[model samples]
Target: MANNQGRSVRQPTLLEVIIVLGLFLAIAFSFVSVVDLPIQLALFIALFLIVILGIRLGYTYNDLQEAIKSGISNGLEAVLILVAVGALIGSWIAGGIVPTIISFGLEIIHPSIFLLATLIICSLTSLATGTSWGTAGTAGIAMVAIGEGLGIPLPMVVGAVMSGAYFGDKLSPLSDSTVLTASMAKVNIIDHIKSMLYVSVPAFLISGAAFTIVGFTATGHVDMAGVESTINSLNSTFNIGWIMLIPAVVVIVLLAMRKPPVPTIAFGALLGVVWAGLFQGMDWIAALNTTYDGFVIETGEAFMDELLNQGGITSMLGSIVVILLGLGFGGLLNHIGALQVIVDSFKRFITNTGRLSISTVATGIMANIFGCAMYVSLILTPKIMEKNYDEMKVDRRVLSRNTEVGGTLTSGMVPWSDNGIFMVALFGVPTLQYLPYMWLSFAAIILVIIYGYTNKFIWYVDDEEEGQGHELDIASDQKA
Candidate 1:
């Protein structure tokens, strides 16, 4: 009894596994159900402790400690990226990027074609901003109101925004999820994007076509007053100009240079502050305030103000908490050995590529059901597939593609997830209402699974390309 904590590491017990699963479920459910509460943080600290407990009970001291350190280290870049994104978003609005995007969105896209317009405009905006949340808060909201004015179904509008948001989110260099997925799978960013288009390309074409047909048939006018009033308010608050794009151009160039996202975004935000102070005529103090503290304005119409009155570092606190807690859940699993136990239990049964793909799909779905978070699904998949991937001699990117082809794209379909909750609140449409129209995301998943079984376009890395020179030693062993 005195030496139990000192005993060598052993297999994780079933109870330990349940604790890991339970932590993920609690954080996901609580965060979605109650966004105001920091249930994610609560779960993070609790899960962190649980891992330590699991280590004391079963894992060796060094193994337990090292896993925790490694897991946290894995998320360091993401944590930096998150903070930089928050600042960039805050200052971008202050610098007129968001307002400019919205003004253009309203100028050309009419309510008569609002749903299709929403999908198209938001896809472009998300690609520009590299952020789904930013597009949703800015242009997406404006599109919703326009869609509503046209008497379009809220479900269709939300589905359209989601489709576009996800499309850009999947490919944008600025996107944390995109960067994270590519890096974790050890795939080059360009390779990951190209590989994903195999499935995403068709899904995108079909989704866009469907929205277009529906828009052509749908008819009604938007509240021009509200749309115009909001743009006017934006124009008043910030000096909008084509020159406003300098900061954006600088950011894009930095990303193209393959600079890390954190520095690029941070420098972009700084450029935004300087632009606002000099070109936009905001005081230096005011520029800084808007950059860090969020800018609010009474656009006369409360509805318009609600749309524009957002941004700053503080706003992303909730997402940050959720992410840390999500990663904490992952850390706990790795610490306890329960994650490995679960994977091993599955890997023994997998015989070929077909079964492995099927299992991956199931893993993604189950992760969604349990965590109710798409990114969390990413964190869990590498655990399940790491060993089988090594055994099958498949490329890591193939495993990564399977993880995301479904997992990241399907979050909005879950009524209990954050994306679903946000959608429902944004448009007052229930998740069930938009489920049918979210064709692309669902279609993508199905196509991947069927294609996996049929072995169509399923490219695997040849032994020659498995250039794990230094990393191979530490890549996929059950022990490390």
Candidate 2:
């Protein structure tokens, strides 16, 4: 048999394309809301429809299978990281590490400025950790509890946390999305991050200002009693102290030293297990179980039980399944030439720099919606748009930055995406409820498009000359 990669096929008609998407969405909505199905199942049902479409398009089952494998490969790394994060969460909570942070955060974070502080703190934590999932699951959960106790709205708080987490994730050299974007565009991670700041920073500033205003103007009265009770419950539940923070600090230090994410995060989890045994007086078997099954606090208070009783590799299973199914759906669509047809159709309207950039952003957002994860979007967007970038003589850094803006920053905005599901599970807020509040995440995309048209910080390659700048770009891309 011959290889099927790059084999030309009939492009899908616009009506056919809309029909598939519409069917998927209709099924998704039904399963997600009407039947009360888990997101994984809903995505699986949608995936089956796409596979059926591929069959109708004359693709063999083998070709579809191969495409599915190839697509899942793009997100395999993220799956592993998410699993490790689950283990980290369980271990950290059981070992009192997360409890210690929550305890301290509650003590120092003033109610009047909590939203602003949440933004900064989450940004710093995500910057150090390089994982928004990790930041959201750990500090984000704690912030939810704190915000509720402060009588602030959950949606607003989630927005602030998400904005910060994504901001750091987009810019952090250690982030998988950041690295993946730079790699796809053939640019240095550092250079890619530097270019991103032109859009990311301003969006963040505006978001911060909004949070600040909300903090001051929020009508909710502070439940001081609830705050004290929650803090006291945390203090009684774990061996809360400064020493418990050592594991998180160690992970941050290792990240600063350019350590890889998997081992750094795994080690942090192990440190938590050790702390559980040493400081929390937890049995070795119990601590080990925590890594597998997450922390279990039988606090009488529902909020505390919900806040503290999450984590473990087991908890991450649903998300892993959703990612695989979502990627598989996209993979099958790509295999059937459905997605490629959409990309090609856009080329006709992309007649200039601004249109090209806008199209790239549009494709990225579409990838996020259809691909259902940032990793998949990042991979697909560049594959569909990089040639256009090269043809336009635009620097790959711009493409890299735009992908982060359109894809990475918008992943959590999608209702059923892996990142969105994770946020919903972590913070207990629906994606739509928090969507409007993620001003920074949405703003980054807008700012980039605005900059794209204004010609601000947009770089281009020289076609006729082999200058030092070109050599430097080549060198940077090589290092990345």
Candidate 3:
């Protein structure tokens, strides 16, 4: 094919795209699951293969390098957030913020409702902050420790945290993914959120009910004595007080006010250092060291030491390397037209609303798997499918909603993706271990497909009412 500038460009064939993607997946899964190696090495191998594919497609090394750079650039913000979160976790633990929260949670929350409470807490935190990463690194960490104290399964706790965090992230207007999806589809952000409610609300309710039922079943295994022991260790080791919560309060207030997440989180980390010095009796230097190398304590209680002895900038280095390699692989695929070819191959099947919805979800998931970041999927999927929605007269809000359902919700399920890597590093739970329990993501995907086929809550553009604030027509036998 010839480009706009008349330069020759070889578009990848469907077979070539499949082979490349398949090989990457195989290598990644093998290294992570079978070989028990760092995911970065696997991603590096995959990236090298993609570079070879780009060369065979007539792209120069410079072109491929630029593509990789561009892809990494897109994820720089997330990379920054990861760094900030690492410091936040370390400092919070040192300053007794996390320990205090965990101690209070152990005392107040009964085992029968711990899972349900975790879901609600994480959902509210993410909704307020508009960043699932922040929520998970902060409140999510505390919840995991508390769940451990109560003898709840680690995977189940992590699953509830994941579901609640993404639930709020998908609906919050302040969320970068939500805003990007709306912008790509050329729709109002509020309309985009309202459109998502048709699916998100149902998913939230279902997930909550499931958690409640599961919590009841799981409480039979509760270890009350262990919970008390953990709480006592927390109080004996750190100055567990209401004052320690100031750092967390500041973070939430700043983020809710639309402050930049990076600075707000950094400030929160700094506050943690100050608290550690004042309350924990650590000198300024030792307190600051915790931000980079992570907090350490010899509480004599093995479980307490294991749970509290985590966080720091150094802790996130491995995940950062994986993210960079994953982004580079995604960038090279786009540069060589591999990703585009895959999407084009699906075009023929998207002949109606139902098929379109399915294709959009599939493409979003594919983009996350290949692009290795939620931003990549959120930006690329809607841009690719916008014209199709317009031609079919479907409301752009629906396009935005489906894009989020597939992209934001599923990002954490892919081990190499930014969200997935963060989750694994923070909670020490493998993506596969928690995949079956990600109720919100699964429910949303199923509901969107059902809505498409049933013609319920599907809106169409009305040419006659195109302007003057006229309402669009909802394509449903039942009232929307």
Candidate 4:
């Protein structure tokens, strides 16, 4: 599909794009299921297909290489953040912060309302931290531990944890996706936030309701025997005191104060080291080593060992690699114009506000699938649909809102995606198992469609007004 200029590419037909994508997905699924290899291997397989497509399209290997580099570069900061969070978790656990939270958590947080409470707690934490990963790795883990102790299904607990985490990630001004959506759609950040509440609030309320109903109906009684054993194990393994919580509290407070994630999390990790050495009677070298190797407890109790034996930079390496691979794959697709081809193929049908909004949702989900992360979806969907919104006299904020619904909200649903891989690795819950439980994720999509079709909260430009644009005129105008 190249004309000249060493790969002036022609747009791919919809069928051509779908065939390649379908083949890539089949390879990925086969690798993950039948082969049972690491997910990164699946990404590599998909990347290879993309590379082949680029070459066939007359793109040079160097061009494809550059694209891959661009993709990996986009996620470098997140990779570092993942490593730092890993260190933070390792230190937090070794220093007794997580154990302390669980101990105190088990006492007051009744098993009956734990899921409801989890949704609220995680939302607040992620909103403050502006990171679902950090929230999931930290407070989310604590909630999972608490849920396990209460005998709740891990999927239900992880579902609640993720639903809240995404709630914050979508609405929190601190979130990159929120900021990116605002910038991309040319909407005021505050306006974007306010408008998003129209969608997010309803989704959150529904999700919260679902969690509450599940919580009250479930037979998730506190396992008094397991709880006592866990408490004893925590008390024996680490100093059980309120002082251990200072590190976690400091991290959350610093994040809430708008400190950069890298430095804030780095400080949090260091505080864990100091706290562990000073309070837990660990040698300085041993405490520092935990940052690399993570917290490891050889408690005689298998359950305690399983619960406590996680965290550290080493533990996050797999996730980091997966992210890089996904980014590289996405980058290549972008460089080869594969994503644009797909979007262009789909964009033509978006003739009105409702169709545009719904199509944007579909684009967001598709971009995440093909582009491999929320970042790409956030970038690609708006780039493709911005004109359609303007043509429909729709405010860009609605575009931004729908983008968040499709992109950030669905991040954890894709198995190899940034949020998905990290959550799976951290919680050991497979993506599909928890996907159904992310009620807000799907709710956001449904809500967007409802809002779109109903024309509620969607602002349209009026032509008869002084803005020099008529509604019917704008809607009727077609691109040459």
Candidate 5:
């Protein structure tokens, strides 16, 4: 390609791509893991390096700037959702919704079954909200506190939380990631979800079983006194009641009705403000203040104080910064053709269905690692592999399913990625600490690779006329 100045522009060579990406990984890992600094700075430095690479590839500064803008635009929905979730969490706490849920949870959930229950509850919430972030910030937080009281390890609790959350995120039709993946692969959203069920359901069952086994065999003694005291603090601090749950209900109902997530969550936050005034005895000013700065209370109980002292728009600022930096870095890499070069390097190894499947999965994983965002991976991976799948006569849904299995599932494990930063910020658990416990993600990836080799659930274009056709017919019937 030639630039506007009539200068020839070329893709980065494999060696140059390797060097730039290797340097980026070294810098990011060194700064984030060893130096214990924030990931934003590392990403910024990486972005700067990519800009130099882009210029070296003969792209003008203007062309590179457009790529950065485009990358950031791709993730604007997530940024909006994060902002809304922050306000929603704060308002819900101020309105006593989360406290009520936690109070009820503590009373009913047994220590022997807490881990399994956490997974189930988070799955249901994420399925309903179509948002792992919202589920994590809300029910996941409550579960963490409950786990603390139950004497279960925090990492175990967060692991269960994330597994369940991502389960819904991967399969839910309402999820943005799900929709994006399906669109990019030219598959129907329903078809995309149905194809993923083969991998996701087994993974979910395995995760549930694992949590159950761990929950039952655990020797840690539950702190009944702590649980009771925490419950009491919740009751005294706010007007906890079933009615306070209305805000959450509204959000779920709106989402179920297929309302847009941003406005739905914002509306829920508004209702929370009203509830806080009516039931929590807070004036409108104080309740509204909580929406921006989060709810503040003096419960005199350290655990209660710590759990409740969160939320607010300001709280999401750090995450937003990380997301922006990550997206910018991804944009620069894409513009410089570094990502394309990396993907092309994997093309020669795709000699069979199994090789193709694993190669696609590996590409998705690498995209998330190098792109610093799941959106970047989801967008780029399918586009890169779409032609390969078509030429191989494979069903497009397989492409979408494998893309999500590789991209969405492992995104939270990359400590510098947007999902990873959000998980860490919300749960205060290091990514590495809870990573091993993400049973569903690990299971899904393994299952896809296994299925690819075994030819199980690997749909082909010819099979679609008889197999996927019937499935689509059934789906249409069910919709009717």
Candidate 6:
């Protein structure tokens, strides 16, 4: 009921303010570095108060309550996905599957062909493991050592390595970013995956071609001997075989069967434990410890030592912390209406459905950069997307999948971003070196445009089924 003042009677209350602000601050403060903790925390806390003050001053109690609910409600499922992603990381590492992948990776690809191979290899491993960081930090490191020892230009190699890692990260259905993107957009993850190929495949193909051309033409020197030794060392350390492909295959089949991700990865992880103990001679007790704690090994070869060693749930802690900080900041921006204001500003430009699709892709790209994390990008995406969808009467999954296609996949090129950091560290190459290899991300962006404006693979809905995401709707989206 409207009050005498003509405002909605269900005004947002003050208590909701306390819950949101407290949650945001708690998450932000938990991740602040020890050295900068005091300053960052104080600023974050002050910002929270400022938001509440701004709302109380400008909005009705109802508006405030709704806005708070709008922001928090949007992210409710995201929190669960984040924790599941954490567990997935731990289980993958514990299973010895990650180490096994790295071992095989070093054996198959050559240092001369390394740049192109790095992109392909990392892409596959990240695809298999559904983890860009794990692929980058492990196989990526080995590639970097091979690059450094070979005298390949650091930036070129780093750029290529990062590009490959993130491509895998973006495309892998097992990835947290992929899963969360689907959830937030309210599309089935399979639909999200299918939609992603609209951009991702072309981008990866072009990137591979570019890197291959560069590899053939480059004058860079590399320590082939050191690379060989490292590869040999890794081969001896783990049971590297086609048999290791089982965990990855299981994930693919389960996802294809329309199973949820948490169980799929959990099952994949269990497969890993069995294989590690059975084939690699890794004791069951040690394998379990590695899953819960962390895992690393020594080969005694100078460069081959840390190069071939790493994984565990512990490896993802740093990434998780970084992710939380970005999410907390984004949540505050959303709470204060900055996010909505930004989204509204886009509406002024969209005169038609075609234009809105173009704009949606642009917004997705920008969100990935500004938010600096997939969780934030996914959360912030629908702020503008829903308005456009409602205005144009396009399917919500169209906007949702486009956001995933554009934002989550393109994070590889941002030099200061998490994917970039992992790639740089992994290859021991600076980001600038392999920028040419990053053409895959660019290609993906272009593909999103084609999908949207061209309506080529764009999924639409029947009048009755619109907005309510169902399995049939998802199947139709893909089929359509």
lDDT of 4 by residue, 319-399 (tens): 998899999998987777777777777666776667888788888888888888889999988888887887676867788
TM-score-best of 1 and 3: 3
Among residues 3 or more apart in sequence or in different chains, the pairs in candidate 5 whose N, CA or C atoms overlap within 3 Å are: none
Better of 1 and 2 by lDDT: 2
- Collision count for each candidate, in order: 0, 0, 0, 2, 0, 13
Worst 10-residue lDDT window for candidate 1 reads: 465-474
Maximum-lDDT candidate? 3
Runs in model 1 deviating more than 4 A are: 1-6, 23-31, 34-37, 45-49, 52-56, 59-69, 112-195, 213-221, 236-238, 347-354, 364-383, 386-400, 406-439, 458-480
Model 1, 1-480: lDDT tens per residue? 222355655566666667656775676556646674545555655555666666567555555556555655655554565566567656766677766666666677766666767887778777776766555654565577556434567778888998888887787777777877777666666767776777777888888888888876665444567667666776777777778777766776565455666777788888878877787777788877765666666757666666566656666555555555545555555555554565566766688777787777667666655444566567777666767776787666667778776577777776544455445544556677888988678778877777777866565544333432112322442332
What candidate 4 gets wrong by more than 4 Å, as runs, is: 1-8, 463-480
Give candidate 6 regions above 4 Å deviation. Answer: 1-100, 112-201, 217-220, 235-259, 263-286, 350-358, 369-402, 411-437, 446-480
lDDT of 6 by residue, 1-480 (tens): 453346534323345435554564454445333344532344345445545654544545455445544544444443333334344444444454555555555566555576788787678767777766555544565465556545567666666766777777766777777787777666677776766666677778888888888776673455556556655665667666777667766765665455665565556556666776787787888766655454556657665555434445555445444444444444445545444555566677887656777777677665654444455666677666866675566666677666765666555544333444334333434444555556766676677676556766555555455433322364543443
| Superior by TM-score: candidate 3 or candidate 4 | 3
**Once superposed on the true structure, which residue ranges of model 5 sit more than 4 Å away at CA?**
464-480
lDDT of 1: 0.66
Poorest lDDT segment (10 consecutive residues) of candidate 6: 31-40
The lDDT ranking, best first, is: 3, 5, 4, 2, 1, 6
| Better lDDT candidate (2, 3) | 3
Every model's TM-score: 0.72, 0.89, 0.95, 0.93, 0.93, 0.62
Q: List model 3 lDDT by residue over 368-414, tens digit each.
A: 99999988899889888888887898877789899998889999999
Question: Where is model 2 more than 4 Å wrong at Cα?
Answer: 1-9, 462-480
Query: Residue 178 of model 3: what lDDT?
Result: 83
- Give one digit per residue, the lDDT tens place, for model 5 in 433-465: 999999999999899989888888888766755
